[model samples]
Target chain A: MGIPIYPVHLEDPKLQGFYDGLAAGELRITADTETGEWVWYPPEIVTGRPDATLEWRTVAPIGSAYTFTTVVRSLLPGDHKAEVPFTVVLFEPDEAPGVRIPGVLVDADGIEPACGMRLRLKPVRAGDHIIAGFAPAQ
Target chain B: MKAGGVAITGVGETPFIRGSDDTVLQMIARAGLDAIADAGLTPADIDGFVVNQYTGHGSDELAHVLGTGERRFAAVADSAGGTATTGHALMLAQLAIEAGLATHVLVPYAIRSTKPGGVYAFHANEPHKAAFEMPVGFFAQPTYFASMANRYAHEFGMTEEELAAVPMTYRAWAALTPGAQKREPMDLDTYRRSPMISTPLRVADCCLTTDGGGAYVVSAVERARDMPHPVVAVQGIGLAFNNWPHGVLFTQKPCTFEFPGEASAQRAYAMAQVGPDDLDLAQIYDGFSISALVQTEMLGLCERGQGPRFYAAGHGMPGGRMPINTSGGHMSGGYVPGINLLIEGVRQLRGQEGQRQVPDGGNSHATTILARN
Candidate 1:
């Protein structure tokens, strides 16, 4: 399976921290500044706390696959024919319980991907940018 | 009855076709006219309208298109997707009729899947999706649902054959349905032969793409007796939202496959003063095999995690104890969302669906349950 290659269009500048975290070789997630509680996918208003500010903090890369799927057909906006049959997994950080970060599973030659399978963060460079990637942790 | 009762008096739909030259408005106009006529009423009789927000049309627009006079009530079903078409639209219509805001209310919805940008365009516009999920190639409905199917199988136990049974069950119904988009016979082997879009989810496992429109009229149950068809009362309808926004829906739910429909089912059953066992048949919005089966469990049709096995046991098929989607659901019939399923329910109550009609138990009553996330 080839690496998925697609442009990351960040409409909200707040999300740039995620990609920045990746560039710095770390898995970062958003949390409310006051409570320091994890809020995933980075919603604009932070639920009920309009006054709360979002802060990105690097968490332990070791986690387990919450759920995953192998995309035999690429449904990205443009043609991604070369990136067929890639498994996209929702990974839960060891520190965060409900927070899930979506990424493509990597470096599992014979290890079958399943829910709760141990994995570690391994950022992968597709075309021009790096995206979240998880490799099986033995 | 209650609140003078609001029953679905008339239903109409354009043919389920792969592609149509007609604009969305044109299809709505045609279907609207047919539904009014089916109700044994003229355009002048319809004074209230409940329109879908996705259709991008207003009540004033429908009035202009249908040539209706003196519009008294107009509201939009903001509940997006199939829920808007089936659940929310019906609730709005019932509210309008009960409030005496309008007499005859029309609910219309149409989908042009082949339109430019296609259906995924809406998702693409989601800023969170663009920045986070899309870059990883985890976009598209099939991919999203496929992931859920895999996780559901792991947690709840679903075999390959069990998953195939969902669409296969619906296809059998489609074979008997005249205007169904796909009516071909599909056995287990045939299902195996179908191309896989994502693992465990073949093309057959997903909802069909078609350009079609369906409309229904709702009026007081007392007035429905004067109409053309049997009075299929809106016995009970309960709509529930888990409160997950579109951006976080796929990834953030406590259980990724959870739709939170059990609450809705309980409310519906209470309102109708009936339970799951009391229904003669049911019509579920089958957008994908996974979500359909999950909702089936939520509706208490079978034990939790037994939706796939329910079909594998042939319970949802023809001559089964509990028939579901008497008309081919979205998977086989056509993907005009929930409106077609609503039309099919009304048709079955009228006992007009020749070969596919569920056998009546004297007076026909079907409890339709559908949910979307």
Candidate 2:
């Protein structure tokens, strides 16, 4: 039999906002917690602090490229064909207490993602799914 | 500096190989025997046993194979990979010594490379693995680290040339280590063009997978004084975890220097009463080049985001401020699990590195801190 699939449930409002932002065009969002401010991924409660105050706030989508890697092979099936190389990048947003976000590069040609290149987060719709991606800032 | 100290008296390792005919049981026996012999003890003296469960070898089975008369302690630790193995082993040895549970403990790992078995299957069962991660084809560790590597490069303005410098420098040290699997020098251009297993990481950036075992014996300092080798003391150790929420995948802002590593280093240095400047040599784990860089910063050797610059400036090389991974490390040295790094640290402290020895000469005192990513 194939692997069993489980539906992930998100209950926290902050986390819900994070996924909602991903679904919408808001590629970058920040969360302020009592321990400290952080960015959400598969969002949830801030770790360590028992009484963490997490709030979802939107910010500028522009970020500076921190690092980038080109993947020649897909780790998952149907993600990308063998010929199409995928570029994964860590983009540092231009906000206070700079946050690093990981995403894929879309529409990047000839220009290789470098350590300090500026890029903008581009949220796209894959069928009905919302995914965040990075492209060189014009 | 005697609040609570443990002594590492004996270290042994099986030669790393691409493929081996020996079963996991056989590897454990061989490595365990060598470690006990290194400690100048017999199986009767081993009161405790510690091993990594993920390696597929069971701790109870290992203790039975070694023929311990009446074992006082047996532990199969998870969560700590290579560096954690050393830290946990030392911790258990110290506890046993103090608690009157057992005087001697053997920590061994027998992992078979080239054979895809054991915990690799467990990854398929993880909730995250089945859901968001595996569906994206992020099957193995390379992809996870590749994502981080890309982010590190984009955030820090680091270059492949700069990134390639870490493995290149490690290979130089490995060249001096006769036991190293890949001892040849690696040039930058060759490193840059190396097969890209994942972006920001190349074939060279990753640690080699090999079949081997590394084991060490620990005992109280008084008991170890009678042994042939000088004792390498475990001065301090610390561990932390990244509790990033799932949806915040890309934005989990972990400070390489500040999180588990740096915090752990601070505790270790405090316990040892030593600072980064006092380190005669180090055996930082190099599972990946960025891992080494992150660890160096966390260990207080350099400032945040300064690891690449420190490596680029040749500060982490053999003759530099703090000679690191003198045993060739996991990067160039065959990965016999992580016990080799600890063994190398002990060897460096004992002045056994020979040509790979640091220029400042022999070291009577050393501290080894192991960090897992």
Candidate 3:
């Protein structure tokens, strides 16, 4: 059996920028004006009040695993066979507040994920495709 | 506050079923008609409509199917796994009534159970769907909640059996509710032996997808006083949003049943001028067992990390201190797009819920507090 695969098209310019930055080895942080709070994945506006402000800033790509799960089910289309028993995680950036990103966990076996596990990002090139995953701290 | 006061005058619900051949419009129309009739009103009395986003049907189409004309307020809200729509609709109705834009409002939702698959794929298109959060499989609402449950279990030395008890207890409650989907009772052994859909969450731990509809008629308090049923005033309501950034996830303390849900509950309680003890019954959204446990703590029914013990003590059952989810909740009551939870709370308060009626003889005009995440 092959690993299930799917593609997500990026739409939001800010989100596209974030993903593009991740693919290019950088991190971006932005503050929501409506809620007067900072957020990741670049929210449109802070939710409550209109006229919300948003400012983007670049930051280092250092974070840790807040929580994770080993997925036994497939949510994609095709089977890759190379990736089975994959792990998905919610990674919390070190310098940001209430900022967490979700990505795959590489080489995650034999080690259980906790609420605050120190993790670092590793970019992998899978056949011309660059993807990010969490690895145990060096 | 001449802004407008909304009161629930009529409520209607379809028998919770595993699946129905009826279209989403049919379900909505059925529930709407029943609700209108219950209110002793007609389609012409309704001038506004509110519905859930992606409810497998359109609100405009539903209004058309019900032969509603000249809708002053028509909206579809997307609260992202949170049951904010109940309060959202209430606020909308209040505004419409206050603005003299509409005297009567209909809040309805319908779900088709034939599609067993979740709607995570479709939700990706939502504007607020976080980009970084998309890559991970946290797409499903249950998964995010399951992670919390997993953390709760790990930190507090909680057991799957303890987690399983919440749903098992609800299943028992549903057994008495004729309109519930899973009316059959299950023992602790059976609940614990169920297949695990997610760690710390068995198949029985989650709510069942079902074909159903829930509708309510809201009007100004003065107008509602003349209706058939006694008016259930919207004493107070509040909504809160927590949009923390990515790093907060790691440094933030695990929710341990105490922190996250409290803010919303406090706002709601203060607005209602009622405490947890004042509630006659509660219809907390129980998308999952652990979610219900967290809600129990958040609603101030019990202390943080004391949910399992409170539940074990039979405090959540009927005749107990807090008779919660009297309509079996989403877990056993049949998942009716989460809106049914609101209607059930009203039903319990109105003493219309037979068999599963609360201990107060279902008479004393009671106050119901509904919390959703």
- The candidate maximizing DockQ is 1
Stretches of candidate 3 exceeding 4 Å from the true structure: A1-5, A12-39, A42-63, A75-84, A93-98, A123-130, B1-6, B51-63, B68-84, B98-100, B113-117, B126-136, B152-157, B221-226, B243-261, B361-373
> For all the candidates, what are their Cα RMSDs to the real structure?
2.6, 5.9, 5.4
TM-score of chain B of 3: 0.86
In candidate 2, the second chain superimposes onto the true chain B with a TM-score of 0.90
True contacts kept of 1: 0.85
TM-score of each: 0.97, 0.79, 0.79
Each model's lDDT comes to 0.84, 0.67, 0.66
DockQ (0 to 1) for model 3? 0.24
For model 2, residues B173-275, the per-residue Cα lDDT tens digits are 9899998989877998778768887776788998887788888887777776778786666666654556532333333445322236766667677766667
- Per-prediction share of native contacts kept: 0.85, 0.41, 0.18
lDDT of 1 at B322: 80
Error of 3 at B211 (Å): 2.3
Model 2 residue runs over 4 Å out of place are A1-68, A75-81, A89-103, A110-138, B1-4, B117-124, B134-139, B244-259, B359-373
Docking class of 3: acceptable
In candidate 3 chain B, where is summed lDDT lowest over 10 consecutive residues?
B364-373
Model 3, residue B141: displacement in angstroms? 2.1
